[model samples]
Target: MSRIGKKPVSLPSGVTASVDGQTVRAKGPKGELTYVVNDEVLVQLGDDGIKVDPRDTSKDARAKWGMSRTMISNILTGVKDGFEKRLEITGVGYRASMQGSKLQLALGFSHDVLYDVPEGIQISVPKPTEIVIVGIDKQRVGQVAAEIREYRGPEPYKGKGVRYAGEKIVRKEGKKK
Candidate 1:
């Protein structure tokens, strides 16, 4: 038996979960998310909580059984509480601003980089150097933040670029005299 698969998934007050064929759908205050379960895995809604079971006792079946359950649980939590990612600009003149539906980033480049905000995700600029990305889908929020950070990755020497908040950049020693 899988430890994580054996655990019950508690449903929140405003959240609803339903299993349709091989797919599990969760609806909450923020939004709804759907996950497809593997053929070897099965999910059933119980009176107290959700139960996950594997059709076969093979290694792959056991792994999928546990992973599917965890994914469903995360979807429930995400729809209820949402997700957020924060990024910071480190360069002297590098900054970010929200213009209409686009994000304008000045990263010491010849021209400012403009990024269009996708639907369902909200981008905010609390400070010119700080960016906050909010969304119910964890994957989408993370992807957007990563793309922005890739535009100007932190330099090893000066660490002057965009990076995740609270992230540490190791500085390398300069040339020896």
Candidate 2:
């Protein structure tokens, strides 16, 4: 019943995918990634591409069907082209820099925040106010970006602090007489 699950995930060029029981593995120019499909979902590697379906008619099964399919699709794309996340730092004296494997952030705090970079992920600062994170695993890439943003989340008042690129913050009006 899920439209996204109904459509097979087509294999892109230079990407090879395989299914082993409930696990799906994909290898491409970028790297290799694997995803374990939920038991409520049925996954198969067909000639057309990867096919996902609900194992049962239960609501739980149906809910997992689309999520399992998307996970497989993410692994395929991640191995083929990798993933990138950009963060923008906004505030007075707020900036980011790379100190070897650690990311140094100065967000108006008395002490600078140093975040240790995780394995299989690369972080860079093209500009003082810009941070770039790259990795072959989509989930890890996104998680890293989120952790960085959490350090100094953007406030609605002045929208100051770290934020995702192009993210729209609903600014709130300040107290007035």
Candidate 3:
């Protein structure tokens, strides 16, 4: 028995959800998103929202049960409220800037790194050291943020790099003479 799968997803006001075949679609004021559920799990839309269940009592079915429910919940929430990710640059010369639809990053490299903005995702650089990523799809938003952070991941020694906001990097002590 999966705890998360047992709870039905609740549809908030101004949000509408529907199930068609194996795909679940959600429409809201922000936008619309869809997810195709796996065959190992069963999905249904009810008054409360969406419900998920395992087709059979097996390890694979049980594993997909909770994940399917969470995916459904994510699409509903994403279409309604969307998702956001923030990145902070720590290096002295490292910074970020927006060039129309492109994001330009300077991470102590000999040349600047340019990243092209994808559709349906918005990237903004409020300050040179702050990067904000916003989008209706949670997966896409998170992936973009990860890719940006990968440019200059934080190092333990100096802790100089780009990292997610509020992320704590464990600093390693320098080699003593």
Highest TM-score, which number? 3
Better of 1 and 2 by lDDT: 2
Ranked by TM-score from best down, the candidates are 3, 2, 1
Error of 2 at 64 (Å): 0.4
For model 2, which pairs clash? Answer: none
Distance (Å) between predicted and true CA of 18, model 3? 0.9
Model 2 Cα shift for residue 155 (angstroms) = 1.2
> How many steric overlaps are in each model, in order?
0, 0, 0
Residue runs of model 1 more than 4 Å from their true location after superposition: none
Q: Model 3: per-residue lDDT, tens digit, 66-157? A: 99999989988898889999999998899999988899999999999999999999999999999999999999999999999999899999
TM-score of 3: 0.98
> For residues 19-87, what per-residue lDDT tens digits would candidate 2 score against the true structure?
999989999998888898888899888999999999889999999998888888888888888899999
lDDT of 1 by residue, 118-158 (tens): 99899999999999999988888999999999999999999
Residue 52 accuracy (lDDT) in model 2: 96
Candidate 1 vs candidate 2, TM-score winner: 2
Error of 2 at 99 (Å): 0.4
